[model samples]
Every structure is written in C-alpha cells, then in structure tokens.
Target: MPVRRDRLRRAGESAFGALLLTRMILMTLLALLMVTGGAWSSWDTARDALRPPQGAAGPLTLAACDRERCTGTFGPSGETVALYQRIGREPGETLEVALRPGTAEVVRTGAPGVLYACLPLAGSLLLAGIVIGGGLRMYRTAWATAGAGIALLATAFALW
Candidate 1:
C-alpha cells in the first residue's frame, strides 16, 4: 500500500508539471500577440497624423471682431468653417488659422483595431499565468491562491 501511494503521488506530480508547462507556453504566445498589436496601433496613429489635409479650396483665416466675437473665412469654396472660441483671446487680436477636417472619426476607428487585437492577447496571457501560478501555489501551500488568481484574471477581463 505504501508503494502504491508513492507511485500515485509521482504520477500526480508529473501531470501537474505538464499542465504548468502548457500554461506557460500559452502565456508566452499571448504576450507576443499583445506586443505585435501594440506596434501596429502605434504605426496607424503615426500614419494618420502625418497625412496632409485634402479638399481645401483655399486657406482659412480667423479675425477677431471684439473680445467675444470672431469671424472666420473659408477660401474660395465658401465652405462653412466651424469656429471654436477660446476664452483667453484678448481684444483686437486676430488669430489666423487654417481649417482642416476633423480626425476624430479616424482615431475612433483606429483605436478599436488596436485595443481589440491587443486586449485579447493580454487577457489570455494573464488568465493562463494566473491559473498555473495559482494552481501550483495552492498545491504547495494548501491555500486559496488559485482562487485569488482566477479572481484577478476575471477582473482584468472585465476591465478590458
């Protein structure tokens, strides 16, 4: 009976070790995916920023009319230019500016591409690390470390 028990224990240890190795490999893959996604996102943002403004009929100009009122002119196309008034503008100051199309849509569209790609990768890594680390710790310490790790992984997934 003692010999049988020792053999069972060894078998269990071997199985656990295999599980741990698998988890580690999965975590490494997730990390790599996250890094690649982040790099792609950075590149997209840079490309968008460097793009020149298009379809400009002429240069836009802004002239101060008074302390509170300002007039903006859109070159030959006579396109209605949106004006944003700053509170700090002093009286008799003419701030000439060129009107460009808003890039908010572009940024908004690009953000999801980056986040969706990276978030899943990071989340998977975190989950695998938590599960393996917690499982091993729990076996050694007979504590609730595994539960804690799972909870942390769940929290990260929720936030992501």
Candidate 2:
C-alpha cells in the first residue's frame, strides 16, 4: 500500500511540472508575436508619407480634331496627358478633367494599402496568442499553488 501511494504522488508531481513548463513557453511565444506585428505596422506608415505626384502638366495643347480636347506633357520626365472637356464656357458646354499617371508615384503610397489589408488578420492572430498565453499562465500558477497546499496537507497528515 505504501509503495503504490508513493508512485501515485510522484506521477502527479511530474504532470504538474510539465504543465507549468508548457505554460511558460506559450507566454514567451505570444510576447514575440506582439513585438513583430507592432514593428511591421510602424514601417508601413512611414513609407506612405514621402510619396511624390506623378505626370506633371507643363503647357496645355489644344487638339486639332476637337478644340475642346487638349493634350500636354509635363515635368523633366515628360509625362504624357490627355484631357477631355466635359462642359463648355458658352451655352451648351461641359467641364471635366481626367488625369492619368504616366509614371508610378514616388515613395509608393501602396504600402498602407497592403498593411491595412493584412491588419485584421495580424490583429486577430496577435489577440489569440495573448489570450491563450495569459490564460495558460493563470491556470498553471493556480494549479501549482494548489498542489503545494495539497503536498503540505499530506505531509502534516503523515507526520500525525
């Protein structure tokens, strides 16, 4: 009877120790995920601010086929432009302007678009990691404390 009781106590202690170690590992992983996500979000915001405009318009040129249609190239890069008049100045006229990019925008505002698209996914992942880690740590601490109390009671009972 004594030998069997000793074996059972040892097995319980070993299981408790394993559970505690697993909880600590989970906490560490969650902290790392939070740090990485924050760094990536900050980097994306910085890249969007420095972008420059594309396709400058120098001198406007009127089209031969239609006087209302004007085309001109602008900037040192000589970006092309095609303008269509929607509203005319005289009665029965339209006014409208359409600008198309001859070259890609400088500095790239697209970074924010990419970051925002992934933000929800990353945020959910980070939230889950934190909750799971915290919950595990709390459970481990409670279990360890309870185990210590039980061990003390067992020792007192044996001594008596």
- Residue 160's lDDT within candidate 2 is 22
Candidate 2: what lDDT?
0.42
**lDDT for each residue of candidate 2 in 22-57, tens digit (9 for 90 to 100):** 877876666556546655664443334223234332
Candidate 1: tens digits of C-alpha lDDT, residues 1-160: 3545588899999999999888767755654554456456555433433442464324444543445445555555654453333233343333323333562122111233233223334444445444444543324322243344455445534432
Q: What is the lDDT of residue 17 in candidate 1?
A: 95
**Pairs that collide, model 2:** 86-94, 86-95, 87-93, 87-94, 87-95, 88-93, 88-94
In order, the Cα lDDT scores of the candidates are: 0.43, 0.42
lDDT of 2 at 145: 38
Candidate 1, residue 6: how far the Cα is off, in Å: 4.4
Q: After superposition, how far is residue 47 of candidate 1 from its true place, in Å?
A: 2.3
